[model samples]
Target chain A: MSLSKQHELHTRRYGRNVGVGLLLVGVIAIVFGLTVVKVTRGDYETPATTTVQE
Target chain B: MTDTSFNSQTGTYQTEATFGDYFALLKPRVMTLVVFTAFVGLLAAPTPVHPFIGFCAILFIAIGGGASGALNMWWDADIDAVMKRTQRRPIPAGKVTGDEAFAIGMALSAFSVVFLGLATNWFAAGLLAFTIFFYVVVYTMWLKRWTPQNIVIGGAAGAFPPMIGWAVATGGVSVESVLMFCLTFMWTPPHFWALALFMRKDYDNADVPMLTVTHGRRATRVHILVYTILLAILAVAAGFTSIGGPIYLSVAVVLNVLFLRGAWQIWRRDEDMSEADNFLTERKFFKLSLLYLFAHFGAILVEAGLDKLGWGLWA
Candidate 1:
């Protein structure tokens, strides 16, 4: 069989494969969105009110 | 890869388990209840969460709940196959194997817990972990088949989502969260016993020791009435708590009256009478139970909304 030929696994289990593919994409979107929100809210920033005097 | 198109032993197309079948293993209907209660819990809290955070919190909580459901299905496949209601489940129907179910359950369990902890507070994550354990290990494994009081104690597992939701906001338990937990806990028995009443002979054939199976049908009816009365008290009293307001109290009072009336009607009938009427009252009560929980939570959500608008009684 040629390398470009579609495997039976892909064709037979199309729904399962597509579902998993979409789920992976959804996970990426959620993680990216959460990161953006956290960054914008300064959830990880050092406290501005704190000071150290030598 | 290797002729993964058939279930040789079952002689069915099990290997081709679709996305829907895998989803079915999660018991989506039960997940709806979990997600709704968790959302109510999160929104009802005094602290406001970021919208995205709140959404993620509820989603993770629901996935964790579904993971527990999958684990329960894996563990209870034998009895599930025997029961008419559960016979079409993925495991029982031969669409998925027990091992696959367990794997999915465990993977999702870990993913949901870790992400929930990262997204919210560890306290809420811990509660989710415990809820999963209680449902799978304690309730399903130990309590369900061993005793007829299974659903009574196992009700705690279903009742924890709201508390977990509250923790997502407050990072700890509180009187209001406990009240929400109590509402669901007190409501589970009558709801399930009604199911057992109408779905007669299901538990008997499964040998699962449900109240209807272990106790006589008359005893089941009496138990339903007693539990209904107790549940009405709890549901009504919840309206006076911090989570409650005028709207909640009104909804609670009306629903409890109708619920108690349904239970009373159920209590007055014998098996012969129930059979003659096709278990109409029991079935009706069962349907009403769904509306009962949703309305109570809906009322609470409304009161929370009203509080935001400064129109709430306690505002």
Candidate 2:
């Protein structure tokens, strides 16, 4: 194979791999961010009242 | 300069740079040790880190370690090209340029530190930054050529990962974490000196001023024996800490005995012995040193697991 052709092949493969890796990282980051936000915000709580039982 | 080569047969220019070459610049073997030790530190900490946070911490720590490796390779390209053991490294072998390695290293160093701070805390990030600076600037650029004690001080850079790991968990340092760091720091001299005994010619040809090259084989052996004795004491004493228990104690005791025996053998060798015979013992000791480290850290991990299961000796 010609040198330029080999270089082109390698560049393409590297680009593809990097693209996939970045995509995965992006998804994980979004999920992690959301989880952090959710945990920090928490949820609404109701006041507790005492009850009498027979 | 671009990493390009003229292919006369193909009558064209091809880029010599590859993913593997870039990855090789990271020194994956060293990164593995950094990652493993850092993980053990996180697990052994009294505080429990969120699983995702721990994953991010380790990832960034590994990146920081890789950054230091790249930067070290960048600065040491000249000496690396001369040393037989390091001649095939990316920059030295013409697979990557020193400039490229430096750029990658700086970029990763920034990325890892910033993201780690955001993911965990500033303390761990700061420690990571210091580790990188110590390795690249202090060790590679300054101490390596100047002193025979290069490994002794430079080993601190490799030692900081566990402390960073512990900081990631507790957002601070402790005696336990420092002990873990000490384990690796103390192990470095004997380990590298053993290799130096067998490969003295490499350092001599490279003019790197390694202990074996500067102090002679006999002195290097004595130094190894002394450091090994100190390391054994520290390793056994570490077993009684919060991070350690019966399992870790057992592992530490057995490993230290064997390690001491190996060091003793190296120390007892006659100056008149055949070079080949001396090389064999040095090589054996060097190989055992690798196992000695991994087993110690692995034992720490087991102790952490046992503590979680409520089977810890102290618990």
- Largest lDDT belongs to which candidate? 1
What is each predicted model's overall lDDT from 0 to 1?
Answer: 0.92, 0.87
Off by over 4 Å in 2: A1-54, B1-15, B271-274
Model 1, A1-54: lDDT tens digits are: 777988888887899989999999989988998888888998889877966888
Superposed on the true chain A, the predicted chain A of model 2 yields a TM-score of 0.57
Clashing pairs in 1: none
Residue-wise C-alpha lDDT for candidate 1, range B1-315, written one tens digit per residue: 564556654455665689998999889999999999999999999899999999999999999999999999999998988899998999878889889999999999998999899888899999999999999999999999999999999999999999999999999999999999999999999999999998898899999999888888899999999999999999888888878888899999999999999999999999999999899999999999999999999998999888877788864
Q: Which pairs clash in model 2? A: none
Candidate 1: where is the Cα deviation over 4 Å?
A1-4, A47-54, B1-15
Please provide, for model 2 over B19-88, each residue's C-alpha lDDT reduced to its tens digit, 9 standing for 90 to 100.
7788888899999999999999999888898787788789899999999999999888888878899988
Per-prediction DockQ comes to: 0.78, 0.12
Candidate 1 CAPRI-style tier: medium
Q: How close is candidate 2 to the true structure, as a TM-score?
A: 0.87
Backbone clash total for model 1 is 0
